[model samples]
Target: MTSMTMLEAINATLRDEMARDDRVLLLGQDVAQLGGVFRATEGLLERFGPDRVVDMPLAEAVIVGAAIGLAAAGLVPVAEMQFLGFSHQAFHQIGAQLARMRYRSQGRFPMPVVLRAPFGGGVRTPELHSEALEAQFVQSPGLQVVMPATAADAKGLLQTAIRQPDPVLFCEPLRGYRLVRDEVPDGDAPVPFGTARVAREGDDVTIIAWSAAVHVARRAADRLAEENISAAVLDLRTLVPLDEAGILDAVAATGRAVVVHEAPFTGGFGAEVVATISDGAFYSLEAPVARVCPPDTPYPAGKIEDYYLPSVERVVAAARATVKAP
Candidate 1:
């Protein structure tokens, strides 16, 4: 086991994939020369050379459009959008063209591409740099959205995304890049999609979260334990092909559920989870499903973001409500 940060784990995965497959290429602004604004792609340019790790202009649309062309021609291209909010520029290319290529082409064209973007607002980044617009992608069909919580999962999921035949939207939690460190397994280990990991086991309430919210949920669970409330924390690593069975089973065992995320509460990804649980696990539910997420507003400026983002206290309050509500 090796102790590594989330950024280091991602860098390791890209290095390994590029070394194993010559077809794997990376394209994004400042990806090759500057190693990305967050430096997640650091040292990759040196290792893979300029040809495979080519830097492009500051145009998300052009970057994703070019990636589709490369993928259609049998090259695995990983396109980074710098930040999640900026992905809107490439929505047409990703949602319309790349997503439907395989079906429209009758399986003649396969888009083995990965669209990576840093998301969430705990890092106090500038406007349009820390938005969690996961619902936008979740609403679009034929696209897989993944958000890994830990360093180990980051490496594993990134590898899986690169190797997948379809387009994958890899949402990396900006807060977890350097804040969290853990012991990652040695050698190549790719975490399969549609799998949920139990971050902590409990019998009281099931807390479902992904990306940066997972850490918040875990912290809330820990604090709740002191008050005699044991919360089961479930990390939904992949959002698109959700691990319904895992979520249902956990909620059934706990008899209560609370879905959490950094996105706005109105039309957020947590709403989808709550709906799914209501449909599949209604009979077993002892309390109404609750959600702990940001308010329905644009991600606030650095000064008031702390109030906008869900904190451990807020999550604990939601969980407590589930247990105490009549």
Candidate 2:
């Protein structure tokens, strides 16, 4: 195992995947010369050459549309969107063409493309650079949505996504890129989708989160432990092929749940988790599922983002509320 940050793990994974599979190529704005905005693709161009790591125009639609063509022609293109908030510009290409290619082609065409973007808040990025719009992508059929919170999962999940048959939207947490660190396995081992990892084991309440919120939930669990409140933190690594069984099992054991996410309270991915628990483990629940999310407002400035994003205190409060809900 090697101690590395999320970005380092991602860079290593991309390097490994490209080297292992000649068909794997990368493309996006400033990816080649600039090495990506976050340097996630740093040193890739020098290693893979310009043909394998092509830099495209400043257009998300063009980037995704071209990737669709590349994937159809036999190349596994890993396209970067710079930021999740800016992805709306290419929604038509992603949702209409890339996502529907496999289903629309009736088993003829397979789009094994990876659309990656930096997401979430805490770094105080400008508008369209820090939005947690994961719920939007999760709704896209045939599009696998992956958000890795830790360094190890970042590399493992990305490798798995690249090797998969369908298109994947890999949401790399901006704050976690350098802040989060873990002992990643020496060799490439794919972390499967639809499997949730239990970050912390407890029987009092289940805390569900993904991306950067996982760390916040972990901190909340640590604080709750001091109060003798045992909280089990569940990280739903992939949102599309969600680990329903794992989510249900954790909530069933605890009899209560508190979902924390950085997105708005309304129409957030947390609601889907809560709904699933409500349908699958309704009888086992001791209290109503609680969600700790930001208000239905735009991503705030970095100065006051603390008030808009989920924090340890907010999660603890939500957990306390869930326990109190008779």
Once model 2 is optimally superposed onto the true structure by TM-score, how far is the C-alpha of residue 124 displaced, in angstroms?
1.2
For all candidates, what are the clash counts? 0, 0
Model 2 CA lDDT for position 183: 97
Off by over 4 Å in 2: none
Candidate 2: C-alpha lDDT: 0.94
Winning model by lDDT: 2
Per-prediction TM-score, please? Answer: 0.99, 0.99
TM-score of candidate 1 to 2 decimals: 0.99
User: How accurate locally, in lDDT, is each candidate?
Assistant: 0.92, 0.94
Looking at candidate 1, what is the lDDT of residue 19?
A: 94
Please write out the lDDT profile of model 2 over residues 227-316, one tens digit for every residue.
889999999999989999999999999999999999999999989999999899999999999999999999998899999999899999
Q: Candidate 1: how many backbone clashes? A: 0
